[model samples]
Target: MAPSLVAVDQLTVDVITDNVSDTYASKPPFAVSELANIMQAGAQEISGTTLLVANLGYGLRLTTRQGSKEHVLLFDTGTEGAAFLRNCRNLALDLGTVEEVAITHGHWDHMGALEAAVGAIVARRGQGNVTVNVNPGMFNERGVLLQNGTIFPAARVPTPAQLEAWGARVSNDGDARLLLDGHFYYSGEIPRVTSFETGREDHLCRRDNSEEWRPDPYLMDERMLVVNVRDLGLIVFSACSHAGIVNVCTEVRRLFPDIPIHAVMAACISAA
Candidate 1:
């Protein structure tokens, strides 16, 4: 079946997890607590110390409302269930409303809280079908080889069966598609076409348990999400753009030449 191309009426993004934090809210937008007050979330905890602690991971809770229909998509879980779940609770977010989960890559920091998130969703859904936007390339062991020739093992992500057991309908594919009635555009395997856009160095992976790590710079499983807002044009969500942010943006332009990219929500930019 073909994916939908309809633009959403409104898009609201909540950074569920990320490496950098701005709880101080010294700028135009105050902290989540103050924002909650503006949002009328009085029941939630609002304290100086109750704010969420930033982690070396990325997760975004996005809600796109088109007319009367509203949908939620969890883009990548944080380092672990504990941190992400805690933040969700503190924020008083309704995980039950999430219908889809999109993973960006196979790194542990990006997918560690997947099981906990699925469990929460199923608990609220009560046998509900939550579609997980994923690809088969993420189900293997991955690592980074340091300059010392030592392999830094990464925490393995949940297997397909494990995700299914946690009540997830895995949508593993190689081509891009739209989710929630075209509210989101999920990119397939990103091609490394840029000459200067070099990928992560020392990125290695092992297929079998006994196999050794090999150079796997372009993580074939890495994908991105694009939400076309009514007036905002396109909001590209590239969490851990291992394939290169420039390449990701270029693809967006190629796909939608008519629309202008108003904003780009990228993650894991500390190294850069």
Candidate 2:
């Protein structure tokens, strides 16, 4: 069955080359042609039900859909990530038409260009309102482990109020008030549905001034955008599936038992 709604887009990743020159000293500088070649070399694309995964160098953009509404959820905006933003703008995909913006797991790479996304939406839609969903506590109190097991300070998590101050409606915690349909249908706490799904043990966050580090667990962070099409079945969109893909699938199945999963799109792999 064809879904009543469509999340149209693709994920593309590009490799950036930094050249070390006196003028561009921070990292490295590369000629426009060289950069273009690097970008062409590292590009990858994937398509699924509710997500259009695109890898723009340091970060990823998961464009989701629900009925006729569309939202572009960003994961890791990247540090000094203007190039990625520009790439998004230039892509065949239209960022101007997005309905909302969500930040997945606070980190500079994930949240840096949030303002840019808002601005682009404004430029395209003109003074329109949008929702920004995030779990600020993920960063406000904990740290995360990199691929090498090296611990890094958690990125400053932004509150819904903070995002609201910047003209966005932030959806924090497990609040479902901002949903277009106002239907709280997802199954309770993921990770509990499957044994393969396990939270990250090395990820920790600090609550007080003390040096104590608490496991991030990325609890509420497992949330994803689910779209139920009249005919096309179900589409699930994810940022970083820290909660485990199997668990996420289980939750989706539990929520919409009759809706077959037509596609699954994600950014990073918690457990493949």
TM-score of each: 0.91, 0.63
TM-score of model 2 relative to the true fold? 0.63
What lDDT does model 2 reach?
0.51
**Which runs of model 2 end up more than 4 angstroms from their true locations?**
1-81, 92-94, 123-128, 145-151, 181-191, 208-211
| C-alpha lDDT score of every prediction, in listed order | 0.81, 0.51
Candidate 1's C-alpha lDDT?
0.81
Worst 10 residues of 2 by lDDT: 13-22
Q: Write the per-residue lDDT of candidate 2 for residues 119-167, one digit (tens) a residue.
A: 6656676653666666545446556778897777755645555666666
